[model samples]
Target: MEYVIKGYEPADALRYFEEISAIPRGSKNEQAVAQYVYDFAKDLGLEARIDTTYWNVVVKKPASPGCEDKPAVMIQGHLDMVCEKNAGTAHDFEKDPLDLYIEDGLLKARGTTLGADNGQAVAYMMALLARNDLVHPPLECVFTSMEEIGLLGALQVDTSDLHSKYMLNVDCGPEGTVFVSCAGGLLQDISKKVRWEKAGGDTVSLQVRGLLGGHSAAMIDHEMGNSIKVMGRILHGIQKQMEVHIVSLSGGSKMNAIPRESDAVITVPAGQGDKAIEIASHIAATAKAELAASDGGLYLQCEKAGATERQMSLADSRQIIEFIFLVKNGVYTMSMEMPGLVVCSSNLGVATTDDTGVQLTDFIRSSDPTIRDHLDDEIRSLAQLLDIEIAPADPMPGWKYEAESPLRQLFMKLYKEQTGKEMVAVATHGGLECGILKDKMPDLDIIAFGPTADGAHTPDESLDLASFERTWNLILATLKALAEQ
Candidate 1:
């Protein structure tokens, strides 16, 4: 199919989107895109500023003909995207254009994320900058980097440069719903260093793979499989029935993603080793039966182990399994006011074992401050019980919903006028830039909404074609309404 840009409005949008697709703006690696924005603004004769601390780029567009005196409004979105790919897929984020292509009426990348999570919104902002027809107040377009890793960019942004009393963040995943609140989160670290000894026997390596892993925060309550938890159960079962020495264990790629696969090395006496293999197969069968409907391809494979060194002592092995089982891995509570909303949750995101000890990382989330604190207390308690060192971190706060938020009302009215249907206002289970930006501009009016996308932060992530036009209309209408006010 041939792509065309007949008008300047969408022409600018399409151009910017295509340009960045080739720039490789993965998280914390958005310097090229940031510089692109800066140079674009300067080339267009607009005053642009770059904040070195947070690496936030802003373009100040002077008010148009009749709107120069109107109150300024800021439109923001992140520039970086989470870089992830499927196993066996040959792709390099450091030097690739994402292999962009249109399929089944949706925009996506080949075997990888399209980065439309925030890229589309950034493209829209860039388009607006190139056009002079957009209505209302003086405008500022801000693009922040390192948003995927954390709210690092927003956390370090110089709010003193902000001249707007009201702000609109175009980072929500769904198309029609307006998100005004999101969950607060923190990263927890737990580690233990214990001695280990070798047990004479036949060594075997176990591999568990093919489970559909997803975002820890968004998919935690789904009861989906977790590699660390599954492998721990197997190890515990084997140790209970026979003596086994754990040589090594590893799982998970990122702290924010649930582990989908794991591998472990253990040694068992030749005679008892056959029994261990049978037990592993049985466990796999049971797990497959229980997870059949959701995780069909889950696998557990055992291969004869080559010569291996010593394994952890019984004491160390027991303590490790106990810690893994004791730590929470899913939702702890549901929202009382909002049905199906996770109020508190935890994820055992990563695990690794070595001669000294094991290191674990857990990601905790909650909309209620008290609940989050209690969960932290539980994590600390577990460390004490296991006699291991525990460390916790303080993260950004959640954006609490405001019942009478004026910005939300305006968004609703505009949404209805554009579509002739009621618009839903919701609080997301995921993170948003609103919470961090609101901290700097305490009274800043904030609302987040974006084009429709599914399987975000995963390989299946894709953007809906229809939502592109709908959301663009809603956004344009909202901008006009703000200007008229």
Candidate 2:
């Protein structure tokens, strides 16, 4: 394959990034990428182990001559990327290679996500491990899979053999910020059975689209519109004036991402179809005006559709609509200690309705355990009220902030000296493997930082090339400093 990145310092990093981009590594399907990392380690004669059960790889390289006695440090990142694309893109993530291109000093994929979130981290580690010139202590490079789904690989991987006192998680977003703490989260799956009845009316399809949905945990406070909730509101408003039965309802794909588009098929009284369309149009206009600043492209369209044989019963339809509108979403609570940071939040991410029932999946996040418990209770209470079954899965622990860390101070001091500016230390609402790894290794001191990447978990994702080089330099400098210690 021809190289796409040219005239860049540390060309090997970009090369490896592009190479990895060719493989299909979305969430649970990470065998090829994990094997690539394992093979690379073996080719370099490094000590490596690949856990096929969880698809995690751990590679260790001995310290340099002068730094052999220095304490070992681990660098970690996930191997999977969130597979998102534009509505009309023809790319298949399972088989097609990413069409990467350079634009205005940033790297992006054509009509799809660039997968740079953790790919760059993997590239950086690979580059460092292949080179013997860098002065650093014994290095442990760890890569886990299925992180986008719920940090499954990290949760299942065994860390008993490794002994790294300090860890650098290379899965964060912003270039100049070091994340010391992150929110713990879990997936809540709610389902309710429904009975269908024969339909006797004209059909209309209602759609809510063009909303700028984002990562539910990071952008919850941004007030971006949730399409599932918005569609429920519009349906409820139409139901107020006319009797409509739901034929089908579906929206959103991933639980971690906010729903951007939703559509529903409903049956209305043959003669009252015009009135229902009018009501839907009015609600769409109002919603557009309300979310203009955050989701400027918000649009709602209602159109005539062919009649369906069966529709949800009026009672079941009403129950589903009411439950959707009542479900809690967006920022639930703000942190008292950290101003402007969301302490607790939940996203009504994936929704679908079928003959058997309606199912809704949500990803709830909280930095405080008590707040997490409260949010769980709130969801359970709502489920009980609606007579739906709710199940929580893969609950992960949160990483608490440490006030005094010599490693953090070292990175801060090094960053100041290199850039002549201070790097910000922050607590993020997004889930990170650092929390799980810390729990597994209680004495591990960890910090997460990465190059600037915008529009993560979306089709518009891009990586800043210059920022990537600078972050690479910072990591090299930090490793060198640790060796000197």
Candidate 3:
């Protein structure tokens, strides 16, 4: 395939990014990318180790010239991307390469995610290691897997060989903004046994689509429509007027992404089909108006569906619908200290009703440990009240902000000198691997910053070329300053 990235500064970084983009590295599937990094390190005669079990790669390069006394710096990023695409885009994330294209000075993937989130970070580390002229201390390039799925690789990777007191996490957003803290998060699954019986009635398919879904933790404050909740409302409204039984229902794919589309098959009384459509249309219109500013493309439709042999019992159907409607979603609260940052939030990421039961998965996030515990309790209490079985996954620790950090202070100073503007140091609502790594390496000073990117964890994700060049320069300058210390 022909490369689409050209005429960009830091040409080596851009070229490596394109090469990384060609590999399929979705969460839990990072073998190929990890191997690629390992091979690159081996080819350069650098000491490297690859842990296939966790899909992590660690490479060490000696300090340049007189900078041997400087503390070793660890550069970290994940090897995976959240595999997301538009409704009808026929691209296989496991085998096929991403179809990358350039648009309006930004790098994007056609009808799919561009994987620039951590891919660019990998490219930066690779380019830096490949160079021989840059004056810097000993470098340890660490790449972990499954960051999008709760930072699993970071939590499990063996870092005993690493000897870095200062770490640079290149997995942040908005160029020039340094992140010192981020929310901790966990995954939860709720389910209930559902019985099905033969149905003899008209079937209708209800669908909710076109909402601008995004990263649950990062964009929950945007007030975008959640398709699962929207579908629940429409279903509840229809059930209030007529009797119906669900045949099958499914929505969303990943626990980290807000569902953009959902559909359900239901059998209603022969004469009540018209009423169901009318109710769905009314609800869609109301939702559109309410979410016009955030999700203007919101659409809901109901049409006659083919006959089905099995349908969920009315009791089970009603219970599922009520559960979805009652579940807490979106921004639960804002931080008192940070003003605009989201302090507590949850995303009803996935829902499916099948032969055995109705299953739902959610990702809950909170910067405060107390709030995180409270949210977990709230979910359990709700499940118990509804008589549903629930299972909560192990939670990752949140990175707390420290007012005094030599690394952050140095980065801020360098950023100001290079750009003539003070870099904003703020906490993020999203979960980052830095939090997990910090917990393991308590004495390490960490800072995360990256180039500007939009629509992450979604098919519309894009990276700004201009911001990429600028951020690259900043990283080089920071490394030089660190070595001088």
Q: Could you say which candidate leads in lDDT?
A: 2
* Clashes found in each candidate (C-alpha, N, C closer than 3 A): 0, 0, 0
lDDT of each residue in 242-269, candidate 1, tens digit only: 8767788888877878899988888877
For TM-score, the strongest prediction is 1
* TM-score of each candidate structure, all chains considered together: 0.79, 0.77, 0.74
- Residue pairs in candidate 2 whose N, alpha carbon or C atoms collide under 3 angstroms: none
For all candidates in order, the CA lDDT equals 0.80, 0.88, 0.87
Q: Look at candidate 3 and give me any clashing residue pairs.
A: none
Least well predicted 10-residue stretch by lDDT in candidate 3:
2-11
Choose 1 or 3, whichever is better by lDDT: 3
lDDT of 3 at 121: 93
**What lDDT is obtained when candidate 2 is compared to the true structure?**
0.88
Q: Candidate 3's residue-wise lDDT over 2-68, tens digit each?
A: 6776564553898889989999999999999999999999998999999979899999999999999
Question: What is the C-alpha lDDT profile of model 2 across 1-485, one tens digit per residue?
Answer: 77777654554688889989998789988999999999999999999999988899999999989898888999999999999999999999998889899999999999999999889899999988988888999999999999988788989878888888899999986987898888888789988888888887989999898998998877899989999999988889988888878899999998989999999999988888888889998988898999988887989888988878999888888878877888889999897666788988999999998669788888889877788888888888977887777875657887877777788999989989989998999999988899899889979889999999999889899999899889989999999999998
TM-score for predicted model 1 compared with the true structure: 0.79
Worst ten-residue run, lDDT, model 1? 1-10
Q: How close to the true structure is residue 303 of candidate 2, measured as C-alpha lDDT? A: 91
